[model samples]
Target: MSDETPIDFSSVLASAVHDMKNSLCMLIQSIDQLSQSSSHQSKEQAEELARLHYEASRLNTNLMQLLSLYRAEKHQLPMTIEEHYIDDLIEEMIAKNEIYIEKRGLTIEIDNDEALAWYLDMDLVGNMLNDILINAMRYSKDTIVISTEIINDELHIHIQDNGDGYPQEMIDLIDLPMQDLNFDTGRTGLGLFFARMIAKAHKNQNKEGRIMLENGGKLGGSVFTLILP
Candidate 1:
């Protein structure tokens, strides 16, 4: 046998990611429990715990997105497109974010037809929205809105916030290639890049999903739209 390293680095990375996710899941749960526990007293302490919660959430999301991108690169990320009520879908996103919304004294708005059902990969799309909400929660002033509609035979989903709006760099990202992300600007391009990948994964007929970032929204801040076909 030829002398060679037996370790498959790709498999090793995937397994390491899986194990990291398990540990992060437990850490997230523990933080949630701690937040709910009344023994937490001071306002500053609570705030710190809440930040921890959000960071934990961010890390967990990062890992999940990594695994998804990996699978997608390997053509293994299955798209589970099915008809789901738009309200229920956004509601689950709101529920996951209930803690931060309450803690920050923020308001959330939902605008969608009550009886509309749309076909898409709910898990992938939902996680995409979750990442959006997490970013919005951190940046918004006091309000966020989630709206959905069928525009021109495609499902249009928008997540808007009431704040200063996305940075000029981020708004400029719409025109840049995926490989043009600047890492030295104290920003990691992973989340937005992941969002873009997710949008592209959803395809129907001859159309495909698209993502855009805009400065002005109904909330007068920034808007992130994922148009799915």
Candidate 2:
């Protein structure tokens, strides 16, 4: 028998995800070019392009979350703490969703200081914000808001939506310890789980980042909050 152990399927899965993400990047780029040209003649064609753009965006987000989860499993994801201004961070998130926001007549409000700086992994935090914003957009009626503040020595980032709010069962998970997420509920659980993992990775003075979910905000819907120390 060969001395080498059988190949792990997990590695294969990771490779596949990487390939998919690359393909998605190309597709997203093409869509971006199309949006810039802004020369669609027929209403149906415009709507179709919008639909494709939204799905591709969601797919891209899902792949990113998967990569984050894989990194967590291998204990290879590193958090690089640096001082980054809050204004730039939230604006980037808004830009990521701009295509959908414009096509759907959605409203976005951002509340953050231009000069406020925080130390955290900017990429991971951005991914968390994008994931939460996508989730919010799915359930929101029209308005979504991104807010940031420093609360009790932790950076508080909130993405709120004005929809019916999260179902009771999903809300219950925040109170309990992290467990095997149920895909049966139509929630991939990757976004929330990845957010929690990224938050936990940033530690300062014995405290770490955390994720919280609640209903009733300025928009009277759902609020996804990340606290990073």
Candidate 3:
């Protein structure tokens, strides 16, 4: 008589995602090395390498998000809210994507006060913003702007692009309550859902963090806003 416990499929999936993330990190490093060493290669080859790097990096980011979501589900994700300078955080985000931005001929503009600081889980917020920035880089034709301002005693961080605005359906999906989001249909819903969860985790006196998706910004394109209290 075997009395073994049944496996939890979600936990197994999380384990798989962790393993996949490690493998992806190695692959990304290898691709980066190849890119740096192949400077003398042909233009087509260079472009191909750049494309490979970008896709791999994007995949790595998705894997990371998946792992974070799994941890959050299990209540294992750690939130360390601290005061961090807005400009410094934005600089790190830009630097992380500098290579891809250059390859795509994109410009990054920062409209944050250097001394402005915010209290939140930097790792969670940073990862969410990184994912958003990656999407912006993919869609923006030339310019992407990162801005922060305090609105009604809440911190407002906005990432706006000069690309075609998000589809009406996507905007609608984002506006839906997190419980109603369909995570299985596509990555868009899942990413936005994760972003919402991360945003909602930060709290203050009667106020909580949130995210908003809008179009027709200063750039006439899509805007992603994260508000924290």
Please give the lDDT score for candidate 2.
0.82
Writing each residue's lDDT as its tens digit, candidate 3 over 85-154 gives 8887898888777767866778898898889999988878888898899889888989999999999999
Each prediction's total of clashing residue pairs, residues at least 3 apart in sequence or on different chains, is 0, 0, 0
CA shift of 134, model 2, Å: 0.9
Per-residue lDDT of model 2, residues 1-229, tens digit only: 5998998756787798889988988987888788778775376766666677879978877777777677778776666889898888888888887777777778988888888898888988888788788878878999999888898989898889999988887887766565766656554466667778889888999998899899998899999899989
Query: In model 1, where is the ten-residue run with the lowest total lDDT?
Result: 181-190
Model 1, 1-229: lDDT tens digits are: 4687687655776899889988887987787787788674587777777787788778877877877877777777888888998888888988776766766778998888889888878899888889988988888998899888888999898999988898887878767787786646643377787788889888889888989899888889989999998
Q: List the candidates ranked by lDDT, beginning with the highest.
A: 3, 1, 2
Q: Which candidate has the highest lDDT of all? A: 3
Task: Name the candidate that leads on TM-score.
Answer: 2
Can you give the lDDT of residue 171 in candidate 2? 80
Residue 191 lDDT in model 1?
79
**Candidate 2 colliding pairs:** none
Residue 149 lDDT in candidate 1? 81
List TM-scores for all candidates, in order: 0.89, 0.90, 0.89
Instruction: Kindly indicate the candidate among 2 and 3 with the higher TM-score.
Output: 2
- Alpha carbon lDDT at 47, candidate 1: 72
